[model samples]
Target: MNNDESQPENNKPKYKGKYRIDSTRLPAWSYASNAGYFITICTHGKKCFFGEVVQGEMQRSPIGVIAQKLWYEIPNNFSNCQLDSFCVMPNHIHGILVINQIREGDAMNIRIQEEDAMNRVSTSQRGDGQRGGVTGLFNPMLSKNSLSKIVRWYKGRCSFEINQIYEGFGWQQRFHDNIIRDEFALDQIRQYIINNPINWESDREHPPHPPL
Candidate 1:
């Protein structure tokens, strides 16, 4: 479904008190590492702003066309980011983003500097479950060339363009991302994205069917 839908509580990161922060990301793994990430970004409230699926094909609305164009321009914006299989759905987009070999000092590890009382507090102490927080603040700039930064850039660019024409256009605050660990998983995810439009009738993101 769309990324706007809430993930299970268990799947989300947890914050217990002030010092400990539990992350949903792979333990001891770095998000900026060279890897393939499957991403899903949804419209706010799961609105079908892009367009609709007709006869197993997506009819790209003006907004949808812009979305597709921007998706391709991602690599041009980020030198290390590469595009793979991607599809613009009615309410969400499914895409494979490959991060090529990163040079030294490109992807920085976000470290919490415990200087003040606020700094000592864990970023997720607020229980928001948002990833990549610096002293309880969501700062994408801290981790340069990271997956979250890349997605944030794409989303910001989309909003900037889409808002000019469609004021109501908005995206869910957080996106869904799954790290592709193996070739088989990557292939399956690619096939799933390719078939999303064909199976729209049964897609969870699809609006309720009209009465017969």
Candidate 2:
């Protein structure tokens, strides 16, 4: 009668095979494109015990902490991308990510080359010629860089760190993603990601009730 027990005599697949794509196996174009996407990633085998709902609040599992930190830093790491909204629950994460194209010969490129030189100079002495200014590190326009690569890179690093913290901790082999084609859809997805934590108790993915 345990909640984690598999359904008796059922052959239903555990995940959406049609939508699941291994982030590690995706082609270059997938990461190079400037298109924005909303992605959902779940724990391996949908394990719910990674964390628990206490007093109507979802507490982060050790793995969840890694996920949250990595998700927040996505924007800083990928100058052309934005982490709009995200929620980390006990066994999964839902996030809205915007991928903007990075234009050639822009500030980002200029800053990249100047980083070493700037390091040698004091902050006050660097003045206007400093290589690693705010404008150099980030692009104001969101459409100039690749978002997919940012997510993949973040996930890869998080997995490595999580493995070090808790032996055998890792994400599933693949993740679920939906490309937002219009503003309306994007807004809806943003709201969904923001509200995910509040709706966790009623989620279909929550462990099923025991049979009589």
Q: lDDT tens digits, residues 73-157, model 1?
A: 9988788889999999888898899987465544442322212224434645565554434223333233456677788778888
Whole-structure CA lDDT of model 2: 0.56
User: Best candidate, TM-score-wise?
Assistant: 1
Q: 201, model 1: CA deviation in Å? A: 1.0
**Superposed Cα deviation of residue 68, candidate 2 (Å):** 0.4
lDDT of each: 0.68, 0.56
| Candidate 2 residue 185 C-alpha distance from true site, Å | 1.2
State, as a TM-score between 0 and 1, how close model 1 is to the true structure: 0.72
Which candidate's lDDT is highest?
A: 1
Tell me each candidate's TM-score. Answer: 0.72, 0.60
